[model samples]
Target: MALPFARVVFLCRWGAKRWGIATAEARRGITFKLEEKTAHNSLALFRDDTGVKYGLVGLEPTKLAVNAERFLEWAVVLADTAVTSGRHYWEVTVQRSQQFRIGVADVDVSRDSCIGADDRSWVFTYAQRKWHTMSANEKAPIEGIGQPEKVGPLLEYEAHRLSLVDVSRLALVHTLQTDFRGPVVPAFALWDGELLTHLGLEVPEGL
Candidate 1:
């Protein structure tokens, strides 16, 4: 028989707490890599010769010529792997990129839209010197954290939590809580410059 609404809520809360406690002490490793086939502008996605980094080097001349009047210019890329269970963590280095969004997206997220434009995605965005946490077309300014050169995103899938961390200061910048519908992949949107993904890492302690 179907349970009552109150019991359902109680079970969810208990499950979340149990999952959090289970992952608190262990160091979980996640594999990460951008998938070229999943990019909105695959032509603009490039990997270094060493195969250790990824970048969006702007649009090609042919593409620009065809859509010169209105080209969004933002390229969104998803990782080759998806996280369906457990807690996964990874970091992204934003050194030369001035405008970008980094976070996680559901497998079926719309390719035409940038990250955080829909309910399927969550991103910590940096644009025009401002930092904001965004999802479902809503954005909230992240004040006083200063500009972080590197951002660490910790995904607790079972608990439905995505936490953004400032790697330099070891500070927890923000956390997004929601019921993730299905498998989620690492997602990135870039207007210009490069983004380096750091994988196979352990979640840092002390939040």
Candidate 2:
């Protein structure tokens, strides 16, 4: 059934107001659709003292498996490759959880602090029911119209920017412009109460 017209209008206004993006032109930059359709099989589990599980299932990309309830214990994982330049994009399907994170990080980033807690990573995260883009010590608030079953991260290296989008809704959640330097890799992190959490990579038709 179609949504009530009033509810649809409310949602549109909510999305734009969710993040204090500051400028209309900046907002436009994030709504651009990606031209590629292939999902890269490049994720790998990045283990640390956080006690998170990561591994590869046959014919599947690396998956981060979490079953604990410790709110401070974060599941940190990374893609198998690093990029120093050019634009890069990928999608991840998240199993339900209280919080989730997606973005890129320097290989040497600190696992002790949450992703984007320091200079090593730039991340889009959900915590305490709020959405944000994080870099260094700054947390950029995002509107998070809804929890997306699928999320895509787009990085423009030369531009030193990162954008988060709801793949299912085809809407931009937020973008972060920063001084993030090169040699970074894709990373994911999440934490929650006693609930099963899984971060899955979406694979394309081609290997």
Candidate 3:
């Protein structure tokens, strides 16, 4: 269900034009960090020179207590920063993962629910060697592009655009256009691996 490459290009161009450029402050970017306090307690957080990593090893869902703050079914976390406006870009490095989801979500997305399973979030998911763009439990297969080791998610708030970029190739993978209900934060979920996040990166040229 991937759009033709030509159409993807046209839509991206239109979005860039419609939103224009972000403020100088936004262009500089800010350091991205995951909020451990808000994350599922079963998941562990580690920091290194590259960035922060969320480790999912030894996580047992069956042992988890029934709590409103924890994501019961999936290991999920959010960034401490929220995007209200302007353009933002961040990179996620996937390692030792069988299945993972990277995306943004409303600040109020329910912790008991998995991301991309409701109206409050959107995600680019990789599972079983297949890739899909998901929202509201609906998934669209992203054809042609092979699985990427790293992904860059670019958010243009005013333009209502969320684009996934193949970091190594610097190519657009997919884009979602929708009006956001409120401020959103970078969201992540994993079934069997860790994710390293890089922030403060300037939006790549022509993407």
Candidate 4:
């Protein structure tokens, strides 16, 4: 049987700042539709399955500039391990490489069937109740002006601090090719598989 999961989607804005992170508005949900026949036919219908699969409560961006290697190392460590009830609950780690402009790592939930799906499309839900209990601490780093002499140190610091929490998935929302530069912000969420019944962002009325 497929384990129950919740998906959380965040609407983000990119500013001219060299670096920063922003959190989504509370009580609002990101929605997507499973228009693809393959995805629709495979799962039960009549349900709004495509939404934020994970519960996204907040977002954090770091200002320190660092190389890709160091940035990933810290991110993996932060996501893989968690401190719960003054004790360690599970061990999470990055199982892949830092080759992509945006990097990702998984927090192993002990059950092979726990987290379903590949890519950033799906993720396992963790600390559901705790997520609600914890208040949002949305923090974005200070923006960099012009190009810094070096981004290595800044990136390294950001990666280190980022590693202290539990994030289900990370997304490189905008890239150089996409006409976005500096402060490559990534968004993370706590996913439950059930949210993907819908997909994509909604258009404003009378678009």
Candidate 5:
């Protein structure tokens, strides 16, 4: 059975912008493009327009039916999670009500760490952790902000894995295309290589 709620968190190293500032029309465009590219149904993509994007799938009713406890757990975590970044590292930690946590840690491993004998090596890491807790009743608002019209649920089980990468890539490519003045094709792409490596996905060999 599909999990009631699944989220693909995009860990960006450089940009920190509000994802919700993206207009509804822009979200619709992204959704259409996503539908064109993949077999699974599309979900609307909302951007704060500053940097971050929140794309939610699956309806609250269906989510509750699928797994009320897990759905609530994710909702609480999504709302309360913290994002922190510095000169050499960036991290986001989501603490679920159930005590489970998911964290994405990205470090600039290429930087020299020999400044001091006590200096610690910085390496990128992504980890998904789970925990269990007794059930309790709780109520929260569920506004259908970035939900596609066609897809029954806000999210698809299998597609969640790819959506984060796809959305981030689309955002990056779209930005690049807009900035270029003349005909330009992708020459090379730079991303958080460590994140991809941690996910066990191979970076595309070429553009």
Candidate 6:
């Protein structure tokens, strides 16, 4: 069951100004200045009673889910903390679900759709020994890194930079530089079958 979004985020690009669309940064050529905004700095689920199982166990992942009877087919969960400014990094241990997505999404992205399958999200996933990145309807192959045991995401909100690090090898796997606007939260999805618990939630400080 998908619930109504608590808020709606409008994405905008920046370069000579704020909220300018049309790949503003491209027109200005990769030189983007930092814009400041106040937003929550901690990460957690919107609520504990999500359609899927969620809670905290010690310091591992502050948030966790395994899915319930109703959402056994597919489900999505967003972190309570929304990043609006500054540079931040975090990691997730993809546990049970053989098919899963890890990345960020707008507050109002389609609840029924999987992350990365839509334009508002930037994510990475693995299934059947293959890895890919999702951007809207496009799924592109990402080589040199496959099925990372732990994924480290480095987000520079003001700079509009997103990098997915292969924590297993301490190497950079994928990177995206965009001016995505809105209250973005860490997004997760599980598919293929029921996923068991074991994913960690604690935000890793850095490499």
Model 4, residue 36: what's the lDDT?
18
**Each candidate's TM vs. the true structure?**
0.73, 0.57, 0.78, 0.17, 0.15, 0.58
User: How do the residues 71-185 of candidate 4 rate in per-residue lDDT, one tens digit apiece?
Assistant: 2111111121111111111112221211101111222211112122222112122231211111122212222222111111001112221212222222211111111112222
Best candidate, lDDT? 3
Ranking according to TM-score, highest score first: 3, 1, 6, 2, 4, 5
In the range 72-147, model 6's lDDT, one tens digit per residue, is 2125555444556555566555544467666776655554456787788887777767778777858877788765
**Candidates ranked, most accurate by lDDT first:** 3, 1, 6, 2, 4, 5
Prediction-by-prediction clash tally: 0, 1, 0, 38, 13, 3
User: 40-79 in candidate 2: lDDT tens per residue?
Assistant: 1122222221122322221122232221211122345544
lDDT of 1 by residue, 97-119 (tens): 77788888876666546779889
All candidates: CA RMSD in angstroms? 12.1, 17.1, 10.9, 20.3, 20.7, 11.5
Weakest ten-residue segment in model 2 by summed lDDT: 1-10
lDDT of each: 0.65, 0.49, 0.70, 0.20, 0.17, 0.50
Better TM-score candidate (4, 5): 4
What is the RMSD of candidate 5?
A: 20.7
Please provide, for model 5 over 80-155, each residue's C-alpha lDDT reduced to its tens digit, 9 standing for 90 to 100: 1112311011112121211111111112111111101111111111112221111111112222212111111011
Write down the worst ten-residue block by lDDT for model 4.
147-156
Q: Candidate 2 vs. truth: CA RMSD?
A: 17.1
Between the candidate structures 3 and 5, which one is better when assessed by lDDT? Answer: 3
List of clashing residue pairs for candidate 1: none
Which pairs of residues clash in candidate 3, taking residues 3 or more apart in a chain or in different chains? none
Once fitted onto the true fold, the runs of candidate 2 whose alpha carbons sit more than 4 angstroms away are 1-74, 192-207
Candidate 5's displacement at residue 146, Å, is 39
Q: Is candidate 1 or candidate 6 better by TM-score?
A: 1
